[model samples]
Target chain A: MNQIDIGKWSQRDLNMLRTSSDTREIDLLTTSVRDLNATLQAFGSNTRSDEASFRVLTPNGAHAIAVGIDAPLNVEIAGHVGYYCGGMNKCASIIIDGNAGQGVGENMMSGVIHVKGDASQCAGATAHGGLLLIEGNASARCGISMKGIDIVVKGGIGHLSGFMGQTGRLVAFGDAGEALGDSIYEARIYVRGKVESLGADCIEKELRDEHRAELFALLKQADEAHKADVSEFRRYGSARKLYNFHIDNAGAY
Target chain B: MCGIAGLFIKRTRLQPRLGELLASMTSTLCSRGPDSAGFALYTAGEPGRAKLTLTSVEERADFEALGEMLSRAVSAPVSVVGRYTHAVVTVPADLVNLCRNWLLENAQDVRILSEGGHLEIYKEVGYPDDIARSFGIASLGGTHGIAHTRMATESAVTATGAHPFSTGPDQCLVHNGSLSNHASVRRELGRDGIVPQTENDTEVAAGYLTRELKRGRSLGEALKSSVEDLDGFFTFVVGTKNGFGVLRDPIACKPAVMAETDDYVAFASEYRSLTPLPGIKSAKLFEPKPATPYFWEH
Candidate 1:
């Protein structure tokens, strides 16, 4: 892996990583580090090059994709990660600055992860824990999961999403797509946006003042735009039937 | 690490409930610096004299002793201003420095937050309301005043690290921003014989601006001088016995919002932080022109 060309990494970091190639990974991520995978291939790590790693790039221009290095690593893609990147952030943090790709923070998780950017889906399709932060908009099927992974989309999530979520939290700052949490298991879906419709036993509950306060508090910390009066949004979650796999709730999504 | 809020009553009609108004503002800023909070307020009766409120005094060993020491130096009757772990002392028109020195030297780490006309200084380690109530600022009354709350970042979240620092007579300043060029400015101020008593960047700002204001410069001119002298981003909400001024640095690294109604005006880090009103009007937001000196007339 050390012999492979890491040139395919983002242009933002090409200059930085080009300057130093042998620093320890632990030191690189002390504050805000860039996740430039291709650059890692050139450095000779005492550990295997195939392992997960995260580094923050200076972000001079907009030209980097597939920012995640590999699995068993969580990369918090800090700034703006450009395009189809983070498609395979299995077991790592792939948080972005603002928005992210068609498939972000996708797949496996013995380790948890995050994506600060708005994902483009299919995000978190398989197992996971840790969390993801989409400070903006998510395009589609944010969490087509089958296992335990907490996917928090602080923005609006797209259609057919959480289609078969087995479990965990699916937080959305905005609306959920049609047939959300469909045939979904114990997964908890909290949305500040209006749902087009419910999938299966998924039901909408009134967002009380306390709930509004809670959501507002979260949005405030994330620096997301939220009206002081958060009564504008609704809440969605499991109807409990999904926990037992009732015949009526089967494929209800 | 401290959060300070002030209420400057424009119309004398709003004068009677000045203390209550200041208490509300201090309480609103509780989250910013929960450690301790205080209010330094002044009414028209006691003109030119600063009445400081030292709130939530967990330690009593130096409280009265410090107050007595300040009174002898200020040459004015520095009475025990309030209660609730807080004390209030008065600085005569010419003895502000002597009073400040006594407060600094006599106490372990004293924060002189807002020593304008009848300075009402209050502080605690966590929770602004607790400090305000403890100091009894909720009942103290005046037209112009300042307060502080803090989230410890650069300096220890102690009474000394609070805002509304005294720069001159009936003149004080509150700051929000990190001074990137603190070392350079400190050296410059030191060269001019102005000594800062704390490690906080704001103290350096207060010290530098205070020196300029003492040299017969107007508040506006002094702030302008600070703009030329200080480096890095900042938005300052300065208070005086007469009124308050809002100034910002060129970069505007931090967020500050100001809104004015026919009756009252408000300034805060976030737009929503201000008390929401009935109208759909938008706030007039301005980031200080980097390195430009700006201030408002009372």
Candidate 2:
């Protein structure tokens, strides 16, 4: 497949290319959300095509861009995106040039999503496995109900983040908001700054050598290992004592 | 789910473009809400007069005659202007309640959308863009405005059921989540004489704010108090005569993003609705904290 130069193509040319089944490498600028979604849907269904890559221009905070991508490909969105970008992603590497709205990389199985700016609430909610990187802050519930996904936020995270988190690792380089990690499970959380309050069943733990090593490796994967020293971060997880029913803790429940 | 957009212009130069900018912001959230849409625009109003925006199934039912009847009853001159299925009635400020009561008795089918010195609300059952176009929103100018596109959860889809529900003079609210204890709260507000028009949780929430503000509580204070009384997941963007405010529940399960520039302060249910604003790429962006009322006034 030849490299397609999106800089020279008009919006109409991009639209025509999206409709053509033979085009493997496409560059799209100024396309409507419906058309772009249609092109991505085609890519998800067409298994016979060779490796395909796409470059999106002027996203203008459109929602649901690059969703349901199951193929192993590359896509770059040049501007900010709205909710559910890279949702249900699989075997892809998606990059965003600007801030993201809610649920970016939501419910993903396997992928690498890079956000150049901050992310809204539930940034990587309910994802199974992937690497979600945010260069800036993430709002409330950043990793709510995650199954197994590694997330790294270079800035602060908001309240109730990592709520009911079952598994995976969440690393924050800045302060965490109130009620962080409410009702959390086996997920490991590493924070570099102060926590306003801890939620029920979530308690601070010692950052042992093993935890430090895991956080260091995760930060390296996010390409932000040098931002903060792994030893400076604190670890948090479930208390585990609440998992079993006890008569003495019935009042607390 | 519902979508909300708000624009507060700090610069007078941008006031003329408020509706156009607001329309674009509201239209970007079409995917969030395709059931119905509405907006409350704040513009200049004559002193000593109050405006009431009402929607009627019958658009051409001689609103002028109804206005004459209201004028005679209130001992003031009243004028009504019809736009599409909505009518704006201007009357003496002291007689606004009398006009509302008279409408309840005389025009049972007509519902007051908003009553304020500067607010004129337009709402309908349709997509956000189509509702904006049908109401000529692009041509309307304002100092600030708020729009809502709703996917109904608690109530049926109707013009009156749409959001930007105004319960007090120059006050409107748009919500993006459902209330868990609305029935009980509705009963509580009913005892306080703040009867809502519908069973929709948002209306109950609006009535709660109005009741608080009527008790002399400030907008920020009312929203702050909502955290304790209003139980549910919610992201609320409220507009007053001279202010714009945003609040989220303690949990903040819903999504809300805000951006501020020298010219304007914008709020959207998601960042996509706010991206089209001027100087947005360089604007100061932040998510409002849970259980905190962030407000800015002119």
> Each candidate's iRMS in angstroms?
16.5, 1.4
Q: Residue A71, candidate 1: how far off, in angstroms?
A: 32
- Per-residue CA lDDT of candidate 1, range B1-298, in tens? 3344545565566667667766775565566667555455665545555555444334663467777776666556765554655556655646666776676676645554555455555555657676666666657666666666666666776676666566455666677667877878888888888767668787788887777766878777877777777887677777665767667674344444444644445555532234432221433322223344544445
Q: Using lDDT, give the best candidate's number.
A: 2
lDDT of 1 by residue, A1-253 (tens): 0111212222211112122244333222232223345553233323343344454543311223434444433244344433345544433334455444445556544233445544555666764543455666665567776355556566677666777776655667677767777666655567767886787766666676655654554444344545434565566655656566557645543
Off by over 4 Å in 1: A1-253, B1-6, B26-28, B35-38, B44-58, B61-78, B91-116, B276-294
Candidate 2: residue B216 Cα off by (Å):
1.4
Error of 2 at B193 (Å): 2.8
lDDT of 2 by residue, B1-298 (tens): 7899999999999999999999999988887899999989998899999999988766556777788888888788998987777889998898888889999898887889899999999999998899999888888888999999999988899888999899999999999999999999999999999999877899999999999999999999999999999998899999999999999888777778889999999998877788779999899988888888999999
Could you give the TM-score of chain B for each candidate, in order?
0.77, 0.96
How many residue-pair clashes does candidate 2 contain? 0
Candidate 1 docking class? incorrect
> Any idea what lDDT model 1 has?
0.56
Among all windows of 10 consecutive residues in model 1 chain B, the one with the lowest summed lDDT is B278-287
